[model samples]
Target: MLGASFLKQKKALEWLSALFLFLLLREWLLPLPSLSDTGSISSFLYLVAGIILVDMTFRSHWLGLLIKIIGTLVIFHAAFVEISLFNPEWILQTLQAVSEDFSRIVNQEWTNMSIISRNLLFSGMILVLVSLLNYLVLEQRQGLWFVFITISYLAVLDTFMPFNGSGAIMRTLMIGFMLITTLHLSAIQKGFIYRGTQSAIWKTLVVPLMIVSLAIGVGYASPKAEPNWPDPIGFLQGKSVTGQSEAIRRVGYDTNDKTLGGPFQQDDTKVFTITTNDKYYLRGDAKDVYTGKGWIKSDKQLESIVHPKNYIWNDTLFSGLETKKVMAVVQAEGEQLPAIFYPGQLKGIEELNPENTTLTYDTISQGILTFNGAMQKDSNSRLFVERDDSTLIPTPVQQYMDHYQLQAEIPVISEKKIIAAGSNYPKDIEERYLQLPNSLPDRIKQLAEKITEGSNNPYDKARAIENYLRSPGRYRYETKDVPIPKEEQDFVDQFLFETMRGYCDHFSTSMVVMLRSIDIPARWVKGFAPGQEISRDANNNMTIEVRNRDAHSWVEVYFPGSGWIPFEATASFTSPLQVNYDRLANEANEFNIPASTEEKEANKPKQLDQMEEADKPVVKTSAGFSWGWLWGIGILIAVGVWILWKKRQEMYLWWLQRKMTQYAQDDFPRRFTLVLTIFEKMISPRYSGETLREYVNRLQISGDERQDLLYLTTIYEKMLYGLKEMEGKTRSLWQQTIERLLRQMKP
Candidate 1:
């Protein structure tokens, strides 16, 4: 009743609603901890406060003031008298409990806010914040400063408590909109923002409509890459680029979370967008340690941090000779903070932003890219790499020379299974992927053998098991009602026998354990799924939007020459059943791996130098001038110019964002001013005779395209002329829309 009545206090209602919107974003997006943890506690307190505030509002001024004073005194007296609010503890004990939760968080042992010592600490903070918000927004109308103050606090807080893509993006947008609301309300109160404009009412509607459109574009237009989560440990350790290779970092992501007993909770917030030459499963972090409870990231391997240029240019040093390259353009969804993800073995990574964020390579995982800090909003990166799935069926083997893999046929009389069986993995792979806890059940082994009864080789056995579980109607794909196994029952055992219900992690983890039981080495890998392909380019490049729900886990089985082969065991996401596997074994090709190597290389362009050398004809002339040469050079230059024109806006925006992230002050508002000034001078180039929108009008663009440009110009005017702050999400949209316009139209 109290929580419900708090809304009756008009002032409390406004700020409290805003706070709820911010808090509930977790439930909407990637809520790390369940809502029942602290969220519910805080909510309950809100209701109680609502009743009190509402009742007090109806009282006379003196009575209301006296009641508030009495309430305060009572609370203090109770604290002094050692009275417990929720538990048998005094105020000091509650404080100690909150302190313990913080310590657990710092240790990275606590699973977010789920099992905190006490809820009163956060509940109390929320109550105080809402009270202050009400006074500022309703009574004093001093909401703008408070809004900025909160945002600044969150940014610093985020370094300590990093948000997922959804959490971060939602936080930015909600706060931004609320800030705009407060600004307009305050302006109206002071005769500014909301004081009727001379433009048509429809003209005023343009910016809002533009925001809606840009929001949609940001959702679909960005490129999806591997998720780079926030690093709390890294943040605390040092701001330097150097760090160890922890498969799991402090990135607001913990796959080892114990979700065995409860329903699966998914967050569908947009993470990143991806555009690629060909669609394939993206490679992400890998976990080798299974502690019976959950996967733990151990083995802190280290490699020297390398710059983007060094990684790309010296490919032979990292990936070896004659490797296939899959080019991808990826966009991370965040404000100025971003993360990185990729598919297969990455040869190079090019960030659109200029932060010069160096990537650390996991010499162990080979393909994984690790960034030191969060990336900027609309930050795009290009990946030159190779995926593991190959058409050449790996030479199945149980025995091979230590140098690499060599084929041999093994015959077993038990089931008269005779097949080639000598595909060998690196020694390190065998040790890591084959490691299984003693608690793993025999049921998993029996099931693996039963599933692959007739299969005579590792590839065949692995494929048989994978295909069986992936077949529809056999195991349904779901995240809810997953049974929490008893203390003695293994997680895999429960899913395979009792529940028979699970999601990607369950399926993948089960598959890995089962394979290991049968002497087939496998490990678990995770990243966001390749989302809906929205558009395809002239070169058949695809654009996809990957969200939080798309985050997935799968199996990677190691094979020499083939690398770590990605296998999909999830029921709903299996690829084609039967494609000719041995067809891609090319004794003639330069690059290794079988399946998609030829497919990937066929579409890739030959080097210009090589092409020229191949096509060169003997032109006997005293002078070096030839009409053919002139024509070829002209064509190359035109193509280069065309490419540059198409990507110019993205290039500019990335450059601007990169600059903002690297600022010594990193004061967002100040950096925004500098960036906006530079954008106008360099990109739009405001002239002496033309108004901002007039300059755009001179382009003679009309209809939808003109509306988009006009919207940007309108926003620019408001931001330049009006005393409003640029919302983080809005800034991301502005950059995206401009880039979209540049790509769509010739201008």
Candidate 2:
């Protein structure tokens, strides 16, 4: 029943042909490996050979199954051979390795050999599925599977990681072939075209050409989507380096995540060492919101510093505070561009080499100072921090807020007591800090409120929540099996209830949520922790060792009068979110000079001119052939050749028939008259009054011509009077005799 219902009713040969064409076109569309790279070429060819072997196994005789399997194995083994194209020893080794260490090869990190090996394995597995398909299902179901495989191969290449190549023409040709093949199958299915027909000129040429033309026309006529993304087409194709957006950051990574997330891992490479008596969290940056799906951007906090002037000498240091200035010289060990690790606030930066780098702020991670390029070796910079009471920055420095905007500013730090500046806080700050997705579980908010119960003020409530996370038996720093929540599943809810196990991201993120649940403003902060001490000076300043293992995430709470205070919530580590440096480091390094008012004004016009110079496009003109025009000419030549090929048989017959018709026009009466006329030229010309028989008798002619002339004379006389049609044999005879007579008569 299965065979009769499907496979028996199907056109096996046609489907096989179509699938082969699909594979061939697909191979053409993908990136080609370099000819010298034997491994890559062999890997690709291995897929092709495997596909053929699998196809034949099902389609050919059942008795040949063992032979097909061996052939496939031999080809696969040959592809994996190293020094020689065909090595028996390497084949044995590859067979052993694939059979024994397949799992190890799959789990290994991406390398040249691994990438090619995995590709070979994946393609081989796909063919294995194809080989089993015939035995498992009917042709109707198999047809669907074949289509799915073909489409999935294209979609994965097009979607997952686009391989850049010739884009439109190859795609159009592939589409054309698919359309033509489909038409052939459909036509044969419905009996529009016969199964036994040897040629399908209409299907091969006309139908496919029409489909391609229509496809192109519709594509141009259709509305185009907006270019919201960079390279909406497959031309610029690769997966985002961050597997998904905003993953946990590691040391030696030049880029930091805007959103803090984990399953965190640590590296032991030191980024930089600091020498400061006060052990405080080296706050790198902060994100204000928890996007349940994990793209936590503080758009409200995002001031673009779009221009260089915004971050460069654009603002003066905070002045309304009784503060002790601290300076530290951070000399980088390696060429890694270290994150500007300042204790309290960044006063200024001076590049050791003016040509080295320019610093920019990612308003996302507040303290991250991104350089255009990596820092040079032995590069060092000085940062000044004030160890004072809680200082609250009402808003990020947008423009230079100098004398006019400084109106009776409340002190950032004081000798006596900390201040609550929330009365003066902008409404935007309050809203941005307390943001939580609506999908956040109510139980999470209840948990936060429960943890912070009985705390009278925001700071006390925040401290209570932080302590709760770092509580002795609450949670541990575990990376293994860290709960990755379902998309709709609340991350905090899962960590807090189902599994009370997580890393820095989980603890810090939970603390922020609990703080926000009670209407207190809180955000996530990430950077290196107060690192381990390496050495101390005579004055009691100790240099520290900060490594990737020291990379951490913590929370920050927003107090009304006091700004953002960093809070450490992870266990097995300790850092005061709010750090106080009563005295500066004795080995104080000078801050890079802030531009004076007059100097800034003078530099303004010069900087604008320089920016204009940088923005301008550099154009260089050279003479060469225009490839667009050349391609147009080539396309036209190809079209002309195609048309000629289509009509070649008709053209050949037209030439032969044209010559025959011309020769035939001089037959019967015309030939006889031409003979007499040539005779007239030879002898004395017969007057118009002379009879035809009389004129012929007067001619001196050869024996065969003379014999033919008497027989032709009677026929001509009858044809002249009667307009009679000559027989086929007589007409053929007359034409040859006349052409021979004309040639003999030539001078």
How far is each candidate from the true structure, as Cα RMSD in Å?
A: 29.4, 28.1
Candidate 1 segments whose C-alpha is farther than 4 A from its true place: 1-261, 312-324, 335-339, 352-354, 366-423, 576-580, 583-747
For candidate 1, write residues 1-747 as lDDT tens digits. Answer: 665433233342344434533443233222222101111122333333552463335434455445544454344323222233444334354355457567655664332222223233333333444444444344333444444544554453333221223344445555555545543443333321234543543354347547755775687568888657533343453433333223212222334444333343444455667666544455557777776555755563434343554444222111211333556666666411223455555555544343434344555544334443322211122222222442222211111111111111111011111123245656776888788888787778999999989766787788678766654345645443345667777777777787776666677888888898888878877765555456677776677776655566778775454345567676445321112222112211111111222224444532100000000011011111112222343355445445644565565455555655565442434453444344453445444566656766665455666677677767756666664766788777766665555445431
Best by TM-score: 1
Query: What TM-score do all the candidates reach, one by one?
Result: 0.39, 0.36
Global lDDT scores for all candidate models: 0.47, 0.47
Clash counts for all predictions: 33, 9
Candidate 2 lDDT, 70-186, residue by residue in tens: 665555444432235354544454455445545654553111122224434544543444344332222212233334444554443333221222243445345545544554454
